[model samples]
Target: MTDYKLGRDYARQQDQNDPLKTYRNQFHIPKDEDGEDAVYMTGNSLGLQPKITATYVNEELESWAKLGVEGHVEGKHPWLHYHEFLTDTMADIVGAKPSEVVVMNTLTANLHFMMVSFYQPTKERYKILIESDAFPSDKYAVESQLRHHGFDDQEGLILWQPREGEELLRYEDLEAILEDQGEHIALVLIGGVNYYTGQFFNLKRITDLGHKYGCMVGFDCAHGAGNVPLNLHQSGADFAVWCTYKYLNSGPGSLAGCFVHERHGNSPELNRFTGWWSHNKKTRFNMRGAFDMLPGAEGWQLSNPPILSMAAIRASLDVFKDVGFEILVQKSKKLTGYFEFLLKDLGEDVIRIITPENPEERGCQLSIQVKNADKTLHDKLTKSGVISDWREPDVIRCAPTPLYNTFEDVYELVERLKKILNG
Candidate 1:
């Protein structure tokens, strides 16, 4: 078992030595009824707002008030090309070329847009594959796509399921399924990190397997985008989509990011749903001519975005640019490892961690399965000022976000759990 001292004083000492502890002050940590900062462990659901967020957003609001129509091109951060300013940094976060990434629409909306271009199912190979426990939005999106193509959703959808009585998915089982149904599978859409189990799937391995079978692969990276090092370009996926509201620490319902591999950047022949914003910016106002699509992921955009939402995303991306994903990921492994160590010390029978045993196989979030416990156990934790999320059945999800969460946070959380479970 890993060693972690179990006292409050030790927890405080860990925080004092934490490299990323200062980042906590940068966000407006949520408060309780008494106005104390809650433990705030649910960054996986909605991140705390960075204090700078308002400043970034106000700048845009000011430009709009002053310049009106001309703000599109004349504002300090011009509305006409505001999205461009975010490209390089966002690309670095997901490990993609600037041409391959675009920040646009919400998570599910971007998923549908990517499907329009990549999920080209034919009669011979029209089936879609995904994890059985995938987020509901993703399952619905894929099912709807199969229905749109005139195929029976039941027949066209294949599930890569975990072993019976097992909480985690197995790669060997996935390989077996692909070998059996490779010819009929059209696309493989998976969560890069499962929201429920917190399992970070191997993107490159899955991409390689899908391509070997002549299948197009895509990922829903809502839980993985900022929590893990995606390396989307090197993974060689046909497409990917993610929300920024979670680990990226943007505001609630912020703009999502989409990526298309560089090989398909200039393929006008590829099917897509488009809008005026996706038209070639150089000649967008010359509207009387043919529809000239912008290359890469930008071509998939369906409308002009809400600049206010983009402003929040811009503020968060600036933080990411400053920290660098490499440094953040390094911290993540240690912080999460510390969390796992403390939790496991509580004894396996009372608390079972459902996420993968291997640190390399998951992100910072730990989904704890409290034995025979109910929502009341979660309530007690909340009453004690621990801010964790309770998923249905019996799991409580706590994420020690590397950008802000310190080792002390994790240590206190586990100590609190021990007190609760012992009672």
Candidate 2:
């Protein structure tokens, strides 16, 4: 293990030797009331805007001003094929083939759309499985799917819950649930990373188990996307969806990504909700013959996308392209590990880190339960110019994102928490 120690000087020294320090200047770190850079640690919620985002978005505005309707065919990036430009790069990010990935609607919308084709339930097999404490939106999406199929929403949802007093869900419990009720389940939809607990699930193992039971498996990777090496294709899940606004550094509410394994990319039997955009490019405008479906994930599109939002994604992805996903992940592990080391030094009696200690099972986020602390602790942290989020009851989530957060940021956050708790 690398030698880690206490004190601000040590943190500053680590930042000095950090190879990725140069990229920090590329983002806008928020300023406190007194005008110093705040210890911003919320990349898990929304990533900071890249400095070049404005320039990229402005290009689309300029093109629209000059070309009007002709921008579809005449603009530099060309609106008609704009989504195509992001296909290869995004596919690379999520470890999927070009034909299997698409940038489309927002996260929940894409989840609903994907369920339209993937979550086909029958009279005997109508149950869906998910973690007990899934993100609210994902829980809502799955529950609605059960009700839409004319099943008892409560009875049709199977929760793979944590043991009696523990906080993390066990895969063994999941195995037992499937062992007893596998045949009754039609879909296995899980969050690739548990948003609150910061636990990254074993996607391949979950996929294999679900498939063994004759179920279609999918993941909502909102927390796992830019934070971990998903290798979604290698995992063999039937489908997956993720939002770009978090670790992707894309703007808020930006377009989400969808992936369909190549095995399903060309399958014509699956029922889908389609529109004009889903038509094959060659015949999309022919307007005379039978509806011709595109041969891959591109077939999921229902409308031409908003160009301005896409420009922001393009700009942020260019930053990722320059640094490479591997490089970002390598730095992420080291930075977050150092943060963990320092927190442990504070003594576990006063604080408990609920996020897994093993780096492989989590991303950058650390979910801390300050003994008996509450939201006031989070408010105090914010007032100290440290931007951290607090979940209800007693947990504070701090994510030391590798892209821009420094070792000093982590040090300052703990120092602030220490002062508040000890005082």
Candidate 3:
């Protein structure tokens, strides 16, 4: 544990020593009324824009203006194989092999597509399992999947809820559920990092248990992708999906990523929704040829790459590449740990941090519950120049992204909140 102090000078001193300190300048931090940079702590919801994003986006615009139709084959970065450019870096970020990863579609879209292939449900093993507090979108998607398969959504859905009165999930509880209904469950889809509590689950442990009982396992890594080091391939999950707009610093509603374990890459028997993009590149343009599926995650692609969105993703990825992911994760632990340290000083009677105390079990986000406070508290913080996410009723989610947030930012956020709580 870090020996955290209670003053602003300490925070600035830590920032001065931070190797990643200069990166804060690379992003365009939101401005306050005085035109000063706001203490932007909502990277988990939407990351700040990188200053260079426009340059990359405009390159694609120039290509379209100059080369027109020929841009697909003749541009600086050809649109024909544009998605391929993101493969290696994204694979490295998520700890998967290049062949097993691809950037495509939106988060829920990828999840549904992955389910089409992995959620092979028999009449007996037709149920799907997810956390009780899963992101509403994930819950809705899974419920719809059950309904689409002609099963009663309510009966087919199994929730691995936390024990009564507890906020974080216990592994033993998950084990117990799997032991009881493993055979009946065809799919175990979990958020790699639970959005509500910022709890990072043990993916490998869950995957192993699910596989033990003949269940296909997958993860919605929307909150984990750039915020934490998710070793997706090592987790032995059948499939995984994540969005790029949050910790990835990509533009809003940008394309997402998908991972298929290398083991299933060549499984031609697996059912999937396919398009010409999934066909063999050589034969893709040869209209007369029969459908030939490309092996690996690329085979999941349903349409040609969207270059403009991809360019923004590429730009953000370049920033990640410049600062290696390992280094980013190292900085994340320190920043969040420091944030936790300061919040704890605010007194447990007044402040409660529901996120795991262990740095390994979370990313940079800390979900805070101000005792006896409501949404008005969140609104006050916003007015005080602290841009954060407010979960209904009481929780305030603050993520001090390692890429651009400083120790001072974390310090100021807590101090501002402390001031509000005091009054």
Candidate 4:
């Protein structure tokens, strides 16, 4: 590991040496009281807007205005097949084949859609497994799924919780749960990265354990899609879903993405909800044509998508393409580690980090547990020009996004936090 140092000069030096530092200019960083860029660190919540997003979005508006209804066939980026353009790039982000990936509805909507196909529960085996601390949206969706199938929501759900006095979920505990109740589990759905703790699960290991118990395995990768490399295909998960708004830097509430392993994609036997878009494009408009479902993840779509939202995604993804994902990951590790190092210097008496310390086991986010602190601390930090977010109770979620965040940003954040705590 490279030796780290304290002080503002060290941070500036690191920024000067950073090859990706120039990328910070491409984003619209929120302004401070002095009209300068704030020490923004909430990419995990919603990424900053890329400078080109407006340009890209405007292109669609112009096409719609000029081409009118013909935009479906004649406009730029043709609305008829617009979603197809995002397929390859999105697949690359989540490490799946184009056939296995599709950009569609919002996150929870896609989760319910995928569950309709993957979470089939028989009388003997009709339970779903998830981490006890999954995002609230995920918990609600799965509970509804369980209730929808005439199962007791609480009785049909199994929580793989952490050990007493521990914050991170242990793989051993999950293995034990599968050993005992895997026979009754119809589905194993988990967050690829825990939103609160920032622990990145071993996707392949979870899938293997679930499959060993004859369960359909899947993941909610809302935080992992653009933050980390999720080899969804090799992980052997039956399906996965994620949003584009956070780390992907797509505009707020942009369409989500879905991944069905190639094994399931080509299998026409799977039960799924479908619509006109799900029909084969060759005869989609025939109206009287037989329902020949388009093979793969695209078959799960239920309606035509909004092109304006997609344009924003395309704009953000283009920036990711320019920087290359692997390089971004490398920068992310270093930036996050530097932020961790600084936090450690603040002393355990003052703060604690709930996220995993290992770079390989977590993304850029580090959940800080400031001792005896409350939402008031978070408010102070925000008032002082640090754009970090607060979770319930006492944790602060600050993420140094590699695409644009600089070492100086991390340094200044800690300095500001220190000042606020002392004040």
Taking all chains together, the TM-score of candidate 4 against the true structure is: 0.99
Clashing pairs in model 1, backbone N/Cα/C closer than 3 A: none
lDDT tens digits, residue span 1-423, model 3: 678787999999999999998888999999999999999998898888999999999999999999999999999999999998899999999999999999999999999999999998999999999999999999999999999999999999999999898899998988899999998999999999999899999999999989999999999999999989899999999999999999998989999999999999988999999999999999899889889999999999999878999999999999989999999999899899999989989889988999999888999999999988889999999999999999976799999999999999999999999889887
Lowest summed-lDDT stretch of 10 residues in model 3? Answer: 1-10
Q: What are the TM-scores, per candidate, against the unseen true structure? A: 0.97, 0.99, 0.99, 0.99
1-423: candidate 2 lDDT, tens digit per residue: 678888999999989998889989999999998999999999999999999999999999999999999999999999999998888888888888999999999999999999999999999999999999899999999999999989998999999999998888889999999999999999999999999999999999999999999999999999998889899999999999999999998989999999999999888899999988999998787888787889889998999899999999998888888888898888888888988988888899988999888888999999999887888889988999999888976889999999899999999999988999887
The residue pairs in collision within model 4 are none
Provide the global lDDT of candidate 2 against the true structure. 0.92
Kindly report which residue stretches of model 1 are placed more than 4 angstroms away from their true locations once superposed.
1-3
RMSD of 4: 0.8
RMSD of 1: 1.4
lDDT of 1: 0.89
Q: How much is 206 displaced in model 1, in angstroms?
A: 0.3
lDDT (0 to 1) per candidate: 0.89, 0.92, 0.93, 0.93
* Winner of 1 and 2 under TM-score: 2
lDDT preference between candidates 1 and 2, better one: 2
RMSD for each of the candidates: 1.4, 0.9, 0.7, 0.8
Residue 131 displacement (Å), model 3: 0.4
